[model samples]
Target: MTSTATTVPAAPGAPAATAASAATGASVAPSARPAPVPLADLVDAGLEVPVLGGRTVRHVNLDLAASAPALTAVAAHVGAVLPYYASVHRGTGYASQASTALLEDARVAVAGRVGARLDDLVVFTRNTTDALNLLASAVPGETVVLDIEHHANLLPWQRRGRRVVVAGPTFGATLDALAAELARRPAALLSVTGASNLTGEVLPLAELADLAHAHGARLAVDAAQLLPHRPVDLAASGIDYLAFSGHKAYAPFGAGALVGRADWLDAAPPHLAGGGAVESVTVDAAEWKTGPERHEAGTPNLIGAVALARALAELERIGEDARRAHEDALAARLHDGLAAQPGVRVLRGFDDLEDRLGIATLELERGSVGLVAAALAAEHGISVRAGRFCAHPFFDRLATRANGLRVSLGAGSSADDVDRFLDALAGLIADGPAFAYDRTPAGWCPRTDDRPRPSFA
Candidate 1:
């Protein structure tokens, strides 16, 4: 099945066509234009790993929601930048000046990629958790959030005044519940996830933004799962703030950003009180710098910022339509295949959710999920996630057992990857693992195994 949607225009300052066309004075006709390059071809597509029974096979990464392998383009860009890497903002050397320029360019790219408004500030952060924590500190009034959020979006708000509304039976009812909460008591912000990490269901941001605005609140979205699969236009959608991680976007260099309005951020005290965050300091007092400088203390992740920017650019070049088509086909296959298995039960948050990414979490009727996850890895070279996935409250409410198995795909995933996982799972469910397994300190492992670790490790 194909996932269909209106083609979203490229954000301001983002590439609208292939890099080759941008370089030369040429225009390619729509009919003659080549298909976007396969995402699998742009990453570590040929990775091989050792499995049980003295065999090695191609590694199938089905755990993209946790962390994705760095795209080859991003890695190449990082390699080119490392030689001249230096501390930014104050050094007089050529390398420092160049590094400073690159960092600022990355900031601009991030802002443009999200369609940030003119007054919005793009603050570099450690990851989504750190970005939300920074926003939590700056928010002036009580925040309203749904109970289905990831812990990163939930925990930070809890530290401040927060109102948690239980999601209703259907997506539409959930929106009504949120509207009711905001009407009952005014909130400064309405925080929510763009896509669910476990169920892969997508939330309608434009509608959510309108709901928040009607209730006199601002909307903030956690787009770690959404950005990889879809394009986000904060300005057009009326989102006041956005947060996402590079690691989840196929740029795993330990970087993230918070893009949003600047008033509250400037009013709040600096997130960290250090050198770069201060404008003037004395023995008795210190004055903090406003904007992004107020929060980015000490040295920043220069390489990470550059890598993230490159990844976003590459995604733009690939185009959203191509990415969606590839992922939609794979997701449909995985979901349908899992549903066909008698022992497997697919999880869902709402009955009315129509759009979702390539993620699925399921429970088995008669096996330890941990053992099955381990068996897939040891015997089939397939990697997946098992456990609470860092959203314990939501997991506890939805799952039948302590945890469930999650299979997620991304830009680098192919149809074969999904098929392999489904086949292995079916075999395991029907006849159990081919090898004896035992619960170890780390989780489950083969009773007698001697698979060699990769030489690099």
Candidate 2:
């Protein structure tokens, strides 16, 4: 359940970390090597942040699960489309028509990316939390969810009288527990995450879907973490509802989607009661529209949708195989390196690295998690997430300490990035922080703020 990487190098044949060989004694050609990812073309392509002693370094972002850098292709697409943008749905102008077409096309693209059924409805919301909250409102009866889920999936259901099933020791047992709960009662929904935000543990979504369906419950997947790292097929998995965010999917913030069967969504009231949701608004009566328009009451995030579509397309162009190769290599390196480190604990229930995303959370012995994170940023320019990572219950379950450090990999992350973090952690463990830091009410920060301030002007 716990391991450490003493050195930075990964162990040989780490599960899901090695590329498949052709056959016995077959050699791979040099041309077959995966090309380096081209995600550096991000808007802040060469941006650097200040570290300790007034020095600056190019940020090594290892927080992909939280939010990813916008792809260059996506930024370019947004720039090209911005000039001709106008109001969607009702505008009669050329720009409006083009914008409307773009939004519809984006909806199709997102739906296609997740393998949504032909009859499924894709409703755009603020983010995954908003999308899940919308679904929570639509459920007619009690919902069943696990305590290991992120707050986005948990809190919404709690408001709707959800049954919280504490996860068992093993993943199989957890599924069995869910089955037992569903069998015990008639639940309206079975809410779960495609992957754990805290541990990156990929849940058994297919079997879960089968169980939910058999118990007459609809399965809703919060794919904010899974969609970025792995492919999710709603149709194939038999998931009735799915929600994800554009920020985690490599697009700009402020847009997310809830894709699922139309019946529940249609029967529920409009998510918003503004302009576009209504078909007619008389003095005493108001009728609502159906489909996505019902929830997207005001002007929708056309730019966000277009950006998301472009990011998804870029990922598709690069191909999942290549991305997975890159992630596997980096994750293996990070995982093994951290596991080998003395006094470091890798947070997860699984002993192998096969059933995880490119995410690693660690509980350190030498220093506080917040201090370690700050030291990494201030001293070594490595940016990783620290603290609870928005999943209090799961973090409480995994971490023996109050806080933990999280490093998540993505297509943009390089092996060099992983090595830098490992080296930084080793240094911190050996020498402590180079710069003086103080824990503030907000969080830990460098005590010395003598560096020149960045000017927006």
Candidate 3:
């Protein structure tokens, strides 16, 4: 179903814009608010790429949900931090002290960004998967989860003996199902995604938190998708724990965080047993430190943390209203345009949901999705994600086929970008791919491919 036909709620404090206005490029009650500026400058804003038939076009990236390109400001911050890169924790040298300060500062900044409580411990990790895995290692008891989760959120809990509740037909029904499971038996934590990575439909955090708390269980949100698109306040929403990745948040230097109350983390053994994690060590026994240092064993991704902090600062400066306004318009246009096509079907988890990110996953009724995705990239210079998206079980239930195409946009996207994608897809649907393609082990590739990779590669 298309979102355009529904009366989706506007971002808080922002005027609503109808699907018609979005399709026709009309302003949303121009007098109601000032016109939005570009959300945030991205590192590769106008990079050119070679398309089929030896033609060049400005690359259009509709795969932000996978791994967003770094913000220009974030890249600059990385350059600034690289000069002082050194080992952290207990180092007396000048560079080490500077790097240590930056890492700790980043912890504070990230915690503040998510409205973390004063007693919360911000543990650094490799990515969202790592963060959730760390939490799974520390959780005191059984966990409850929904079937409509990415594997990172699902498998970790399953390994630790979780109660999996299949999602219901609608979001409300799904909430009820979760409540029923929680009431059936007490769980230590109710782990869920803040938004579905496949459908981009946002879940109500406060409501979920309330349900978990009512059943005497804590809540942990996998905010990998939610944090980058919208704001999250753990304190205000009653969220007990939060996990997210820097890669998805415009800083791709292998860093993420798990922020939550310190009791359980301190109670559990150190995530890794090594130098920085221990206070004192004997040959056979060691005393692990508590708090963040307990889990962070060796050298950390100091530059990555610094870059993430800078990227969050940039997003704050751009303001949430402007970001929401820009993405809302683009998403409406995209969903409405695709739904208008004869063979295209936009995937969604809930029919009654209101808010979503600028992410749309679709399947073609008449053609191979893998082939179409390849054509979009080779012929249109458009980058989108195709396949199971690392959620195979969820995909098997939601899709008729084994895979689908996902087109997602973010801060760097523009009206022109959306229009170009719509036009290109329409053309492809009408005339088929311009060049012949063949299935390869990697995926579908042009039969006689001649595109050249950048020299750096």
Compose the digit string of candidate 2's lDDT tens values, residues 62-162.
Answer: 88888888887888898899998899988999999999999999999989988999999998888899999999989999999998888899898877888
TM-score per prediction, in order, is 0.91, 0.90, 0.91
Question: Judged by TM-score relative to the true structure, which candidate is superior, 2 or 3?
Answer: 3
**Model 3, runs deviating above 4 Å:** 1-37
All candidates: CA RMSD in angstroms?
Answer: 12.0, 7.5, 7.5
- lDDT values, one for every candidate: 0.85, 0.80, 0.83
Model 1 residue 304 CA deviation in Å: 0.6
Off by over 4 Å in 2: 1-41, 350-353
Give residue 300's error in model 2 in angstroms. 0.6
Error of 3 at 269 (Å): 2.0
Deviation (Å) of 405 in candidate 1: 0.4
Find the 10 residues in a row with the least total lDDT in model 2.
Answer: 17-26
- Give the top-scoring candidate (TM-score): 3
